[model samples]
Target: MLRSSLAIATVTATLIATGLPAAACGEEDKPASEKVRVSGAPGAVKNVKAVGNVPDAQGAIAMGFLQYGHRDVMAVSGEFGLKVYDLTKNPAAPKLIGEVSLPGLWETEDTEVDVKRKLVFLARDPRAYGGTTQTGESGIYIIDLKNPEKPAILSYTKVPAGHTTSCVDDCRYLWTGGPAKAANQPADWGGRPIWVTDIRDPRNPKTAPDPIELARNDGKTDYVHDVQVDDEGVAWVSGRGGVRGYWTSGYHRDPVQGKVRRATAFSPVPYAGGGIEETAAPSKFMHNSFHPSGHRSADGADSNRWRGRDLIYATEESFLDGCVGDGVLTISSLQNSYNGEGWRSTPEKPFRLKSVGTWSVAGQEGSDPTTGDCSAHYFDVRGKVLVQSFYTQGTRFLDVSDPTDPKQIAYFRPADASAWAPYWHKGYVYVADNTRGIDILKLTA
Candidate 1:
């Protein structure tokens, strides 16, 4: 976490020293080198066009979706606060139905939505409003989305972890995690861990005193970034160490504790996961991940490739000097990672998941070699196609049917593109960019 922060700060300082406009949320004046560029194969992804766009939607970091009045509604959060858009009438052009402008709501990269409860959890980073990580307020804003036209803030519950809040167990509770360690935290902590919050009562949420998923980074307590719950109700926690899965509910045999205990949101039982192989991901920081549970291989040649396997598609995010040192998409198999290997893993005896495959936009057909903001951010999967956002690299559509060798079927990277996260809703791809806002794109092929 410190490495990423240092690199970003150095880049910003250099840009300012050279009188160059620092690339941020709403910086309009860009250099000549920052021109629009796009690339894709003919058959892989055809007819890639921007159907609609929110040009002024700068600082757009993350997006969430919910249903209100039987219509698809999108809630986007960033430095400009949260904006709710109606995606029903026009999937391409979203109409801003409601908004909560907080000017400096920093880093809610993956917003959580409770569709059944009509609530949106806006994660508040400790570094929000030009505050330092050592001493800043961190928590979650429970926003009521009952009326899409008039979204209201139900409550702001304070928690130790708040870079991203994920709804687990049918939105009954939330697993809040990361930014960096605060001043009052333990001295040996690498970064923040996951804190459980009881959100059953939306207006009166309470955070657990203890944190889960501790000592994740090779026996050291590191930063826990985001949580993704799969179809089987397994909460996948991704961060500095690697990606790990836990059972948040039900009575299950605890692999770590070695007993049959009832798993709750606050006390989750480790299911599987471990450190990602260093070769596949040099940077220990994992941004986010997706698990293809019960998903069969789409490849006809090797139909049984992923039939009985638990594969995790993760992103190793890091902002280094060049693209090579940056993050990449890694396909890791959790075959032998079960039994709390990641929890008990130590530096002397490290436990790593098997790396099935890896992919990156670095040295690709249409990538800028000079751009430094090329780390992988967030991604979404739909059958064989995996759409991901690679910061300045734009959005990439990969054919993940063959997990071992993921091929880029299509991509959309403009000159000034700062694509943060890409989501697949309905039949189109919605890209949330820090500089370009929301871009609605459709594939012709």
Candidate 2:
């Protein structure tokens, strides 16, 4: 059998010593324990208050913030199952109102909530459920969130691959992507491609029989890690080969064919993208992407930073032995990627997009060497500041007003925190820690 990642052993050790199951939730009333991890600089932004704990959270990876009428809830996806906490009453001390057990689920890496549709999509990855790399049943678990106090499963569609899944066009469809493969994938392919699913009918979902073969990256169907939809209705997919953008709806100028074309979830036309410049990235594994549109993209002091241009913020995830070999944050100019040259390149003709800048935490202040797998995982961009999760390095806040030279503004690293992703919500930052739990923090100068 293939071995687990280096950090998995450490996590196992902690679970054993604490007498907590590898995949179980801690009690809500339990007080903060001395065993919980916490480490950070005196002046840096620190956890204002944390609700979930180690024993309660098997391994929290991703979370979604939602508000239905009078309830503001946080949907946390972890090793054990999906948990929902009400944050409206108290943002820090979230009250656990509901959850659904997904035994043998492997891992719910990420969950997306459709506010209008009152639906939630949970991702089940093969790596966790089957404990294998290339084989297993992966798909999305649909849940009805109409009743926050009690969430019920609407349906489950077993797709080709499911490392991550996201909603497109107001919950009308979903783009599922991955770390491994389906039973019928091409033998020589490195990873899985984006599979489309129709969920217009919340009770009954339909998945396309075939996966999206864009012939991206030298005409090879490489893996697509994740998909993020921007306000302008552009769905961006990121993975090993590189990051690419697509217009899922409406007729737009095809950056590649240089002609206006129709677009849909199953057959999205190439909008803007090419391979990420390898020379600028330590690792080519693009984990996820974020693109803020119009006024939202210019929230902070970096008003003009992305005013007239489209900026693609991506997280590069790598498991290289030392921290130096891990992935970094890549910022690329979407306009530059659409210069009408990179869209048609193939193996015979190679081309890559220009990176606006790339940032890493090798020698950053407050960095720790003992941290397990110090690489970028996931991030959320807000205004000029980008809040990112760096495995064991903790949560970092960077100033991206100047994309070419990102500056570290603040950080929160508790020695035991294995922060996987960060989400900005209601003026507060919520960090999904794989080892600890959901850490709540606020930016302070």
Candidate 3:
């Protein structure tokens, strides 16, 4: 929880000392060279358990989870629309909690729980107009998850949302980013227009007038795709453009721009992988991508204090995935960039991760040979790992003795889309897929 305060304090100090524009603040030192992924066969995750089965599930899309109260039971979330599953019966087969319908076609969703306040918050496009995947959704829907079996709609606050959000700050404020363009004009579609709502009163949550919008996402092709808020409530927001963009990450092209650039790469891109030919950020500049990280589950062992640690991890994706997640299919700049580079810097917290290098399984041409998704991440300090599902790339584990440079200790992936994010508790990782439903893997690694 204090991590956010530290980040903010650090930023404030840097701004004051260097007097440099956030854009000019260069070289965040702390082992930028350690983009490593150690390999260890976490054995075959034969453990199988079903949380709940939803019919016509295009994708399981289990993106977020929360454990509330002294028992600190786990509740999971998915889909851009309405989906609330109850995993209280067992960590594996979560019974049908309840589903609250969204008014319109909503996408780019995330959820959070205020165990202290007994409220659940899920964010999505408010679907005010007839839902169309073209026009993105922009709002946060409030759900009260007091009764795990029966979660009902408590309130709804219409807000802009480009990607997802981090709810570790206070559970009272459901924060999200997505610039609401001039209505029908989809200019700043999903950019950094960070909006925070105060949900102190579960029944009547109100939107706090003052919301923080990231400067970069606001002007360009708006798209604050994802965020990770620390315990101090300082949200680290990120995004990609629908067309073209300019950020501290430098100017980037969307699918539309990439195709144009590639056509002229031979004529324009002076160098090979390191030049315009490598359109992305030039692998040299951006060390990583896919804002991929998660909230360090420092309390999986002690349900009484789930919000103890102040860390969040998220993978980075410049544009959108074509075959996987739906809605506003923005093309990827990862391939077109300066040789497929990702994040501009390494993990902010170095002491948190081990210095193990990537395994031999790493891909040759930035293909992320490991599981397929290049990175499989989670929250594991006191023995807990959270993961992000990358299509066929399965789930991965990290020995979070150090939070920043996570050690790729173990992983499990199917050859198909059935493998998704894994939730760990009591030494078990709950792996769920659309077709596979849910499978609980007891950690033997």
Candidate 4:
């Protein structure tokens, strides 16, 4: 049964308190003994070891960062709210310095950070704190990160969409998106779309009346999961249909509308991207994406085939009957996907991008076949290396130098692992796990 992350958390907490097996939480379908016993890749990936772990601090979800003086501090958001840790003293073992107690803060998957403004945006899902979609409060909590040791909530700005909040236009604005439709939502909508919020003045953040990135799922306005801004200032929205990129800043030639227009946060111009092919990902839901070339190379570069932001590395999140049927890491080429093909796509006349490659951990090395919660979740890339989290399947390290065929170079999955998101910080990879807290890993291969 594919349950929401919050519902799983609520059930898991109850199961754990009553001394019941956590396998019944609808996350891990197998017993702990049947899960992966080892913690690191021995032969497949050499020298990749778990250096440090914060086991007691369970219910950890996603990780973000904030600037503390000259050091880059780590901020974790999960069932315990948000906590700031100093990794300077020991990169492997982070020291907890400050924290804000948001006990039931649910589903802030990709925590957004404004390094320059010293702020953190925590998106509150409607299902947070045992609330239903009909009456649950959905909004954003602007946390002042100026004082890392004592973080304070600046304000709670309400918005229609709140599954994840992403900083747009250098944190001047925000694009918040969803879990499901709230009360009195559009009848034609399958799920929630994105809502723009003006946070230029962080204290008094104002939300736009309307939403952006409409009709994302094959012409149907569906669930917009998360937003990731590329290095070129183009914000990519991922959800039920696929991944789409929009220019949020300067004047650009709108490929879809075929005109030059100045793009704003609220009114973005279609740049590139569309839906992923069904062959690569049967489930069209793209949890998130990362454009490797967006940060380094120019568009249409001839040096490398995958460079020039021509390809998008995305994670298809799905929980099926078995781990083999779950989501996989998909590498899609944005060759002919531009010109608003995704926006123009319909159920009968669908337009999907060409998938170059795909990777899964179902029958991979050091995998536990019994574990059912094996869908790929959040991932982080560094150079040619990409580290991804797959719930009970663990943290996987892949070499994406060849974008068409991503090969697993290393892996770290303990017996009681429920890795949510893996982040590459400094030289170590920090994994925020639901069962285990923060597991710091080092890759020597």
Candidate 5:
């Protein structure tokens, strides 16, 4: 039987950890945990184009994967685990060279990569860990990528909020846009802000700007659904269907003498309180929570909440069905601004000629996971490819050559599909299909 990449799944999607082991990160060289075996796709053909298989023996299915650097090592995160592999020798027919196992860290919703640090970050899957109701930062595991075969376990930080969708370089910040839902009874439907963490030390990662800087999405409107940062480390978050003027008003705080004072009153728990609480924005700081607003874009000759594409790209995921499913891909550029002396605010507008694009799943063949919900929906690394998988729509690829004119270039859908996100590795695709199997795809230029 073919061995596989180190665990493979959640870690790669949340941060960046390619296994092949480049020369070394600076001079701090490290070794992998064990000797990973060389495993191949179950039934491979010539050129292989792409291959997909279960990420680990447990079989949660690989959900996300990423590759980095001139060396081309691969890192993929999944439903139950995280792993990295080396595809440098054979990009087409990559063999498992390195791997990591995150037993309780399954249900990996998404991942992001920091190639420079040879690390892959994972956003914990609430369902797998305990349930959406259980509040706590989904486990954040970082994999050392110096030696693919002998990769080391860097550290796993516990986040008390929900899991994050992506992380930026500088390794200082990572953002999770999902609302802090109830740990087990996920029906509260709270709107959460983008939980940004400071991982400067990695071992003891802390929330930046503080977790108390935001609120959750109410059922009536959109909340911050997803986010991404640019090379400059500016965070662009999508306030799916943002609404204004709604918050916990019962609580109060005051500046007594020279210090900020506070008061409180009992109220129903925040959306997913007890488990998923609003980041921690107090009523007194409600204005602070909504400081950075949207500006108009050039095409609309309008404004958005931010500007400058150098630091980030924040787009609104079209949520339909009264704000449950995804509909459009809101496109815009971004740059961070220091406002009111570090109060942190951004005025934005549509960055491109068009700020909205219909990314509805159609014409694709597959048994989608949900009746209609796109998860892990995102723009690819080349910044030219928008890759996302609908729970039922399958893996859809759009040629973002024009960002504004993001057209479907290629797609893959399996009849009777399951619930796994699709990932791109060295022009190839890897998917942890709910229970079907891990799949690989080779995309054309």
Candidate 6:
């Protein structure tokens, strides 16, 4: 993998000379003539700042936030490598400060940034630079962000599964998910299982030599797309089968099996889980999720109680022709699933999760007329507000204070938008747009 070290440096130098902070490709040599398409109801969010590109706009995929001293730095991951921009000087307009070229780095949906430890974990999918799903080398690249301006890669440990990697148990361990099945992998495996990596020693990160495939609800090697660990230290693995919550490290009675057990990264004991039961939901393909506890209903009647009642905000990433079967956000109750047949149940007797609410961009206002993917991708939840990305639909803000009836508070949808993910930081929203680059927005009161 290090064979492209020289090429990486060469590409970096060329890009620097071309003058970054320029407009996206197809308009790099031109001026800012095209007006940015902005839309939202009156008193909605405002697009205070709009920029073209950061470094490699064409390959810009995901965005991560980090705060260094009083300055705010954002790391954007793309095809070639990762780019860090200093947003402290001006949140609206970012200044490119660092670049690390990774020539063949594949699809990086999410980059886990440990601001406390000053490290960023970049996952390398099996699908190589060309975007082919064929088996290839998949792993995570550990980068030291101690010097924000000049980042360095500590090491790249090859893991069996690598579509996305998330830090668990306070950055001491990393649970990498998604399969780029190796030659010796089991033939019956569907997609991927959770692969544990002990990164307590960042310099010498160690991953299990063999794959740890946990038999999921379907009694099959379920495809674990992404893992979202809640504030309560529950690692929720979402995939084709559904979403299952596991206790990584804790001493609690199993909600489903009704037994006392210890959990760990390598061996996750099931807490609670079930399939999403929504008629409008096309596929059961659950992308990613967010678990918020201690949330009371709008009327202040029901709240997350002592027994650990919480709400699961999940995004379904399904795409189809003519904007049909687009993904949406499904709100489910963890308590309902806990009382039912959870992770311990088998395929013969499956229980469905109770979906409380669902919000989509199917018939929503400000939708692009052109044929494109309207499916929801990655999103960020801040309090009662959920900022989600709906491909060409741009970024939409939904007020989930009333979980059942989510009100559309604000939105920023450009005609040519290819919005990927949205993150709320410092009272502002930063969206990773594939077309118009990173769009900075401010939510008005």
Among these predictions, the greatest TM-score belongs to 1
Candidate 6 C-alpha error for residue 349, in Å: 1.7
Tens digits of per-residue lDDT, candidate 1, 1-445, equal 1122333455456445643212211112121123333333221223377788987677788888997566999999876888999888888888888998888676676887887888888888776666667787889999998888888999998888777899998899998887667889998987789898998888999888988888999999888888999888999999888999999899999888889999888888889998999899876778789887755544433322475667899998765556776789999999888787888899999999989999988887667776667777789988888888887778888888778899887888787777888888898898988778898999765
Full ranking by TM-score: 1, 4, 2, 6, 5, 3
Task: Sort the predicted structures by lDDT, highest score first.
Answer: 1, 4, 2, 6, 5, 3
Tens digits of per-residue lDDT for model 4, 196-280: 9999888899999999899888889987888998777888888888999999989998877789999999889998788899898
TM-score of 4: 0.89
CA displacement after TM-score superposition, residue 235 of candidate 6 (Å): 1.6
lDDT of 1 at 256: 84
Question: Which segments of model 5 are wrong by more than 4 Å?
Answer: 1-71, 134-139, 181-189, 194-196, 207-209, 212-225, 239-326, 332-356, 363-376, 381-385, 400-406, 418-425, 430-432
Clashes of each: 2, 5, 57, 0, 82, 0
lDDT, model 4, position 255: 76
- lDDT accuracy of residue 392 in candidate 1: 71
- Ten residues in sequence with the least summed lDDT for candidate 1: 24-33
**What's the TM-score of every candidate structure?**
0.89, 0.86, 0.54, 0.89, 0.56, 0.83
- RMSD, every candidate, angstroms: 5.5, 7.0, 16.4, 5.8, 14.2, 9.5
**C-alpha lDDT of residue 138 in model 3:** 53
* Candidate 4 residue runs with Cα over 4 Å from true position: 1-46, 294-309
Model 1: pairs clashing at backbone N, Cα or C within 3 Å: 35-415, 36-415
Off by over 4 Å in 1: 1-47, 296-307
- Candidate 2 lDDT tens digits, 1-445: 0011333353355445644321111111111121233344332334333443434654677788788777798888776678888888788777788888875554555578898867889877765544444556678899987887898999988888776788987779999876554546787676678789999986788999888845565677766777888777888888766778888889878766668888888888777776777776544567778766643443344343455666778877654444676678988777766654555667687677778888887678868765545667788877778889886688899988788899998888776667778899988888888777788788874
Q: Report the candidate with higher lDDT, 1 versus 5.
A: 1
lDDT of each: 0.78, 0.70, 0.36, 0.78, 0.39, 0.67
**TM-score comparison, 5 vs 6, better candidate:** 6
Report the lDDT of model 3 for residue 172.
43
lDDT tens digits by residue: candidate 5, 141-206: 666766667666677765544445556434546655443344342343344445556666766677
